[model samples]
Target: MEVVSEDIPVVIAFTPNYFVPVATCISSVLRNADEDARFHFICLLTEALPEHMQQLLNELVGELGRFTFMDLTGTLSADIYVDPKYTIAASYRLLLPDLLPQYDKVLYIDCDMIFRNDLSELYHRVDLDDNYMAGVFEATLEQQLAHMQVIGCAPGTYINSGLLLMNLKKLREDGMVAKFLEAATQEGLEFPDQDVINQLCKGRIIGLPPFWNSIRTFLLPQYKADFLRFYTEQDWQTVQRKGNVHYTGPKPWKTFTVAFDLWWRYYFKLPKPMQALLIIPTKLSLLAKIYQTFLGKTILDGTRALYRKLKRNEG
Candidate 1:
């Protein structure tokens, strides 16, 4: 397929362990995209893919859209501290402007999400003339303020980095990469890459609608009050319509959640072999938990109850 200038450029980063999640993410996007829509995917890798995984990825890329594998080794300096919890690949998004100068715009999406509708609307809808990038605001003002303090950005300027519509030309013109690198090296942030992006592009980051990046935090009971306080009923309705559900914590493949079923629906759509390889672990894990619960209730607890009942009858 000839990649036209109008084709949207998407970038996703992952380590070797994340191949399955990234595959599911790409599959979900293609499934929902318009028939003629084109996407040029840039896969930033912390390590090279295994041969089998590479073959699977190649097949998927060949069938759906164009892709390029970017090796991230030796590219970023060690002074940039990536938290042990997150892979170094998370920081690769900062390199996009310098890496893809041919494109005026690019979209960065986390691998831990699934698209519910065509992304062409999001790509074409958000205006990026004056903004460095467009992203959904953090869930609460307090969280946003905390991030703002870490990055020295103004309140409400902080955004979740899971989904971003980047203005690559403008960022490149401003030498944002150098600035981001300086800030990242100087400061140890709670969310390193995201904070650096917010700090460097503070006033220039526009807040898009929440539906574009529906974070899992909003659905948790602890955050429900904050969710309601920040968003209106209409906003919630919009999320239901076309929101890209981001599995920010406890991925569906590892554990079951309200969204796990949705993730599996897309997983099942994959070729049978791929499905078997990926789904078995999740299914077995769930079954193991169920079996443990059954044993505790029927074997251990049941014997204890029986002993208690006999003692009461003797009394």
Candidate 2:
């Protein structure tokens, strides 16, 4: 049966395998909404996702009933055409034209993000003067060059695609999809999608801030940057009180161990018990991801060593 749900206005994302918890972006937006109905969270995929990822995302979606699943491969919607490449988020830009009519505006965020505060400001943040479609801001040029080098593009001129506040109508009018495909094939363009978009939307873009498109904070980088702490720390207890949140990487779900628990605590205080239960394990799974990350592995190893020590003490 066709799922004839009401059309919504808000953010959108195209993720496969449920590998990343993009919920951190939606969670804060939903929680901080005074209107409660201002936006919706649309999840686009070719098939049904894992039941476990669905559970947490469902909890995050809350009563807004804002979460949705799209089987693009099953449908002839002609809406989304994402090339499954790790480069420039090819699949995401494909979601533009088809997604435009669904919402007046939408913010697309990578799953590696954690919301430290409300981000509703992004909803209607488009700059119409230039007919510019979407806006993303970064903190440092060094970081920008780093991101460029990641997807194989040259240094000094790359933009991150982790978080986007898009004006869908503008994107469609610009024929953004065809433009992207053409740009992707352009010679000397190494960072397929990111480089194409930066050149396509270049001056027309409305510059926001570093926090908006905080990039490369999650993955392994040549070195660490401090701006990351601005988004992820949960308790704010440590001297290094978490400020930065990762935008993409294996360490994604791990932020929950620090932040999601605090988020759930506040969720329970304001919401109900059942709702809280629905959210807690999401934290575990995300945090469990630390087993593969540097910090997670180091912590887990220390934990095991401590456990053995305690057993030896007791013996």
Judged by lDDT, which candidate is best? 1
lDDT of 2 by residue, 8-123 (tens): 34444445533334554566556655554444556666566667667666765666655565545543223323344452233455555664464545666655555553455555
Candidate 2: list runs displaced more than 4 Å.
Answer: 1-8, 12-16, 23-25, 32-37, 50-59, 74-90, 139-157, 185-190, 217-244, 254-315
TM-score of each: 0.84, 0.59
Query: Model 1: how far is 311 from its true place, Å?
Result: 34
Show how many residue pairs clash in every candidate, following the order shown.
Answer: 0, 10
Error of model 2, residue 225, in angstroms: 8.5
Model 1 TM-score? 0.84
Question: Which pairs clash (backbone N, Cα, C closer than 3 Å) in model 1?
Answer: none
RMSD of every candidate to native, in Å, equals 7.7, 9.1
The 10-residue segment of model 2 with minimum total lDDT is 231-240
lDDT of each: 0.77, 0.50
Off by over 4 Å in 1: 1-3, 61-63, 141-147, 279-315
